[model samples]
Target: MTDIDLNQILTFVKVVDSGSFTKAAEQLKQPKSRISRRLAALEKALGTQLIYRTTRQMQLTETGKDYYQRCAPLIQDLENANNAMTSHSVELSGVLRLTAPEDYAKMILAPLLEEFLKKHPKIKIELVLSGAYLDLVKESIDVAIRIGTLKDASMKSKRLSSISSIVVASPGFLEKNPAITKPEHLEQVPCLNFNVGQKNRWRLVKDKQDIRIKANGSVEANSPELLYHFALYGRGASLIPEFLCRDALQSGKLVHILKGWTSGAIPVHLLTPAQKDIPAKTKAFMEFASARL
Candidate 1:
């Protein structure tokens, strides 16, 4: 009798799953004769029949069922162990690519990332910041920090929080329009929008109704940093994130407007591609940022 090999056991499992010797042979990239020969050898070596085969079906024997249940998890564990060891070597000390929106990158993620770098000194992080949605697989990014709504179904996500949006203006700008009290009053005042050359429309919800208002500011920019500086110079009222202007509102450089109406909150999420198992480095970063962000 021939000795049973590990490859034979794996091939047996595949053949059982595929339910046809020809199909299993095709999947394993081998000839049907060789596949049948291997299974016969495996059964001979074990001194018992594993599978009872028919023309249209293949069913496991009692011994085969018990053996498979015992061996499948062991095979999976061995594969996982191999992958973990190899990934730690290929992944731990290499660069991890990430992406995010500019405002979140500059104001929220940068400082937190700096601290993370200090902790994992060997791993390098490269960040791509943009307002448009980035393709995680096409860009080969390990992860992305995104705000607003996440509509992509192909990726996995862990939500950080729902950040509040506030209507803010420079104290001097608010001084010029002192009659503002409710949400609809925004239509009468000079408003700022950050769409650059695009249409300057602002949407907010109050008392279960959605309202859209067109902005009428003298300045516009694609960059939130530029818009922030413009708001500081008393250009006009800009709708901005509460977290971004938290210090300014506290310091009285900017004042809150439309206190009764709000654009609601946007969710922050950490997204990654749909992989079989997440890598150790990606898992580490996710755990760190999930708590910190």
Candidate 2:
């Protein structure tokens, strides 16, 4: 009935997801007593017991389960529509929080973000650069730039670009090492490990042949960026992103090796938390980065 409050229904869903009113209060920054009152009121309005409760744990009744499934998506659709309308009328002016890889944050996003911010002077940006995975919803991140495949199908993602990696060494390292005529020659040459991946192994595919090398070197580093510097210093051959190492490869600072081979292209995505409607800034930035990347 119209007397059944929509906010109570939303709070009910959150309570179910958070497992208890106590946890839901913490997540929503609301009072547990208030949540209990609302839930009781919603049940009274519906004239049915929606949940089976004890001091220890709670379970959803058949009516509650059915009601939740039906109302949750309807609430989301309503929220999305409301957000879309509200955001369209206002100029974007707020903080936009984002997380991305260190290499990308420095080499790629930095410049693009500068231009984007200039165009929207009222907007502010907070960026976190790391290789570690973060919870977008828990951390309240506006957007994230993730490499390779995505795991969360619930969150909205936009494919920006494909990042392909290449194996390269400094001109000096190659000159000092063997002729490197084939992929097998890499074993003779020192191959620095990138981020301890695959434990001294390099996977390359070419000619429909899958080549897995027991690759090792004098140095193991945490980032491809670090290994890039090591390779520049003529330490060892390393695999680095092709787009990132473009300048170094062009100026002969780094020379491409193992012709007709690659570690393969990884799909990069712009990710945002699952929302009925995405925020204005997040949508704008995703479009901006997609156009440039």
Residue pairs with backbone atoms closer than 3 Å in model 2 (clashes): none
In model 2, what is the error at residue 20, expressed in angstroms? Answer: 20
Q: After superposing candidate 2, which stretches have Cα over 4 Å from the reference?
A: 1-89
Question: Across residues 121-229, which tens digit of lDDT does each residue of candidate 1 receive?
Answer: 8888998988778888898999998877788988999999887667888988877775677666777887777784337887776778888777777877777667777
Tens digits of per-residue lDDT for model 2 on 1-293? 78988789888988887789999888778899999998999999999988898999999999999988998888778877777676667778899999999998898899999999997778999998877779988988999999877888988889988887888999999878888878888888788897544588888888788788877789897788988999999999988888778999889899998877888778999988887557787877887899989
To one decimal, what is the Cα RMSD in angstroms of model 1 from the true structure? 6.0
Which 10-residue window in model 1 sums to the lowest lDDT? 84-93
Number of clashing pairs per prediction, in order: 0, 0
Which candidate leads in lDDT? 2
Look at candidate 1 and tell me the lDDT of residue 64. 91
**Model 1 Cα shift for residue 220 (angstroms):** 2.6
Superposition error at 244 for model 2 (Å): 2.0
Q: Which TM-score value belongs to model 1?
A: 0.72
